[model samples]
Target: MNAEQHESGSWYWEVGSEQCPHGPEPDYDTQPEAWDIWIDRHTGSPQDVRICLDAPAGEACLQCSEDDGEMVPWESCRIREHARPKQGVVPNPGAEHQPVTVLVGTLECLDRECDEYFGDDGDEIPDMESCSHIREEQACSCQRQDDGEYSNDPCPARSLSVTGGTA
Candidate 1:
């Protein structure tokens, strides 16, 4: 997804951002094609045919000067990890069923109806700077990239969690 590849092969990967003497260096871009191949071969998820990073406007990095460019977690925009029902996957009629892991996130709403949250036409808007007062950080029950473990209130932040499912 990197429109500008700095080196022969650099897609930023785990090296998200680093603090240097010249302030935070721009997060480097990394190879995304490798992920498509890896997901398909390892997970056998038919990634090329079914998987994609869905970026809602609220989650996009609008700070970049270029309006038209590839999106891949460049500045404040972190392509959040999420999933949806895969299409074209035929279910096995005879396979035993079990509970599945379902992750739920939180959305902080205004204490009361705020006019700023709506557009001029009366429709609800998304990620407008005017509506920032109504937005809230997702309660932190996020996974730790370093340890790969789920945390509930890990440190100063932790969101709710759903149990009974194996990942």
Candidate 2:
């Protein structure tokens, strides 16, 4: 069976190999140009179709690139007018479903009030207030104890824990 696009952009397919006086005309808003439309030979109804928008200007065959890595023009390709899947046949569901894992956690950082200082390499810079270069370090306003602990106030560093999911 063959199909044609009307001037009004509607699609119609031939009833059989030979043209019938009365044919089925399916009205589609847009034309299926350049793509091969698979139709049922007996009913002249569309089953499945092949479309390749990325195909350069004249290429139409979907397997052109897969066959020889060369695009076959629509005009040059042989049109398989009678291509349709068997009626009422279901396709196989490939692959088993895998369980999805979910995780929940909190993200926290040290507050600005915390006087923790780190060097350019991310190593903790000790004794910032007593350092000779303390004047050069803008963030060095150390109020920490000599034992490297927060003096009077609690440590502002937050502890994050995973409270949910398969940890």
Candidate 3:
């Protein structure tokens, strides 16, 4: 850290690790030495300067001297991609004695209100093709109540078949 008095106000700037044009700047060995030099030129304590550093850069820049102002740490903080739920209408029920057929498809964030699927790109979609719950037929096998004795094979009950979807 280094400071120089200007006409408007004094300013502080840090030069660290990197080689300076004039060999090394004053007190370049350690952060404490740099702090000492910075304090000597400024009127605040080291703790005060540290508080400023810990604060968010947006507010820090607003309050701190323009020459020493730093930008917010944007690179350190960012939102990563999130898995969004795909959307599609469930198929309607089929005719009598037949189970309803449904084809589960994936839909990107198309509606503005749905938070789960809201996305900027229309193509970004959740994996609906691999969902095991989606089957080709609604119901395949049937189960019957077992008799007390063994070999309680009974008539199969009416069941729906899975038509299509991710499966």
How well is each residue in 1-167 modelled by candidate 1, as lDDT tens digits? Answer: 33232212112111112311122223334646655543432211111222112212222333231233433333222222222112233224453332223232211222214566777899877765433333222222232233322233343321133356688
TM-score of 2: 0.14
Clashing pairs in 1: 10-29, 10-30, 11-29, 11-30, 11-31, 12-29, 12-30, 140-159, 141-159, 153-158
- What is the TM-score of each predicted model, taking all chains together? 0.16, 0.14, 0.14
Ranking by lDDT: 1, 3, 2
lDDT of 3 by residue, 1-167 (tens): 11122122222333221221122334545667765655453343322442222222232222224334443221111121112223342223342232222322221112222334334675433642434322232321121112111111231344233356784
Model 3 misplacement above 4 A: 1-94, 103-113, 120-167
What tens digits encode model 2's per-residue C-alpha lDDT throughout 1-167?
Answer: 11231011112223422333323333344534311232222232132323222222343443432343444433222322211112232223341221112111101111111224557777766654322211111111122334222222322231132256684
Q: Write the number of the candidate with greater TM-score, choosing between 1 and 2.
A: 1
For model 1, the superposed segments whose C-alpha errors exceed 4 Å read 1-73, 76-134, 141-167
Q: Would you list the rank order by TM-score, best first?
A: 1, 2, 3
Worst 10 residues of 1 by lDDT: 7-16
